[model samples]
Target: MNAQAPHATGRQALFANLLFWGMLLVGGGALAACMLVPAWLDYQAARQAAWAAHARNDALARRITAQQLQIAHHQRDPQYNERFIRQEFRIPTPGVQVVTVEADPTGIVAPADDAERAHRPAEPVFPAKALATARRSPLLAVFVLDQTRPAVMALAGALLTGALCLISGPRRS
Candidate 1:
């Protein structure tokens, strides 16, 4: 009976130790998660923003490259300016006269009511240069944040979580 009593006490102590370690691990994990999740989310947001900015910059660069190529082509071609002018203005060549014939008012009548115009969809205008100029680079913004309070907060949270975890570890008998 005396030997059995010691065995039961030993089992109970072992159980208590396991439970204590389990609780400590769970608590430490929870604390670390709480500290890390927001920072991780913020980092992801910043990364996504940077990627989006990079995509936009890439698109702009492609567009500028295309435009530059077109300009270079036009500069190289002697007849390009004349062709452009003729296409744009519908100007006749030398000794050629232009004639305009208007349709009879009775035969072709314009819409009398303003409702038709109001219901029509407006033309979609893309002012690419304006948009590009207006937007700040996401990489630059991220760099700024890295140098600011948010980065410090994240670092401090990580350090604190690590310290807590170490403190909560199983003790040596």
Candidate 2:
């Protein structure tokens, strides 16, 4: 009986040790899997978002190109500036003057005749080059797209860091 007791004690001790190690391994594996799996999901999401952003940027580039083509077409026309001025400012040409005739005596104004307008020289054409220069720079869209990349990277990096922290942290208690 005494010999059997010792043998049983030894077996019990071995079982206890095995259980402890098994629990440690299982717990650690679960922790690691939990952390890593979520991180992978986040990475995938970020990659998809980045791809979509790239598509959007490409579309924007196409839109800008179309706008540039339209602008070029307008610029190529010799009378574009003249039409623009006439439509925008409602300014009459030098020979075609605007005459005002006041119905009331209180207003002092008189309408002029066609002979005065005939002597006047034609209105000079307005140049578009100066207006183009005054407009905003074309590189602004590229700069904005360039700036967004870092922010997207930062978001994905943060998610990875958080997942790592969860995996490395001590179990429940």
Candidate 3:
């Protein structure tokens, strides 16, 4: 029995060391995954939002510049000025005829004139540069781990720690 006692003590010491190291690795890994992964995902989302806003700003700037050019052109044209005044004030110019078209009660306008449609600008396409920029964002291999809830991650860590400790058997001292 006395000889067996020393063997039991030795086994306990070995298990205690194993438990300490296992807890260290498992606990550290879990802590890092729980905190860092979510923060990284959030940062990625914010960056994408900012890039979209920048692209929208560029599109609006181009539209505004186009509008300014149209205004300048209008200001230089006597015909446009006369038309504007007549349209706004409903005043008739001498020797000029104005035809009024009444809208249907259902409120849908008749098809626009082909000439009017031809002069309208096309809708802008999404910028290729923005798409390329988004595509170039770095993808993390650990992102798969992010899908698990933080609480679940914590629970898994606890379970693993408990399992390892159990495998190491009871503490001696």
Candidate 4:
């Protein structure tokens, strides 16, 4: 009986360790879900806001570039400037007679023209230049833990060694 006691005790210890470890894993997983899920969601929201800001900034930059080009055009082209002044500003030239035409009120009265104009595409808030491909994430890669740290490496090595020992069990003489 004394000769077998060591092996019997070893088996019991191993069983207890396994049962305890299993329970710890289950509890740890639940705790992680409770804590980490909300944090991850918040992180996602922040990331989205950051991306939106970038989109707005890009759109503004493109708008600025277009405005600069327009200013350049206005400065360089006398024909464009004159046409823009005449058409856009409604400024009459010195002698050019302008004609005004209106739809005959006596003709068949049509319904409000809102429906026809509704089909015209609305202006986009963000320009196509500002749009980015929907990738996994526009932000930098994120990690829950720093894997490169010496402490982390040591911990991983220890866990691996312990797992190997657990799997092998007590060595037989």
Question: Which candidate tops TM-score?
Answer: 3
lDDT of 4 by residue, 1-173 (tens): 99899988789778858855664555444444434643565566566667766766676678779999999988999998788788888887887997889999899877756435444444443212122221233321121222322343354455555555665676455
The candidates, ranked best first by TM-score, are 3, 1, 2, 4
- Predicted model with the maximum lDDT: 3
lDDT of each: 0.59, 0.55, 0.65, 0.57
Candidate 2 regions exceeding 4 Å error are 2-10, 91-173
Clashing pairs in 1: none
Clash counts for all predictions: 0, 0, 0, 0
lDDT of 3 at 75: 100
List the pairs of residues colliding in candidate 2.
none
Could you tell me every candidate's TM-score relative to the true structure?
0.44, 0.42, 0.54, 0.42
Q: Residue 38 lDDT in model 3?
A: 54
For all predictions, the C-alpha RMSD in Å is: 13.8, 20.3, 9.1, 13.1
- Residue-level lDDT of model 3, residues 51-137, one tens digit each, is 766776676778779999999999999999998998899887889877779778898877997446534654432333333343454
What's the lDDT for residue 159 in model 4?
53
Query: Candidate 1 — number of clashing residue pairs?
Result: 0
Sort all candidates by lDDT, best to worst. 3, 1, 4, 2
Q: Give the range of the ten consecutive residues with the poorest summed lDDT in model 2.
A: 125-134
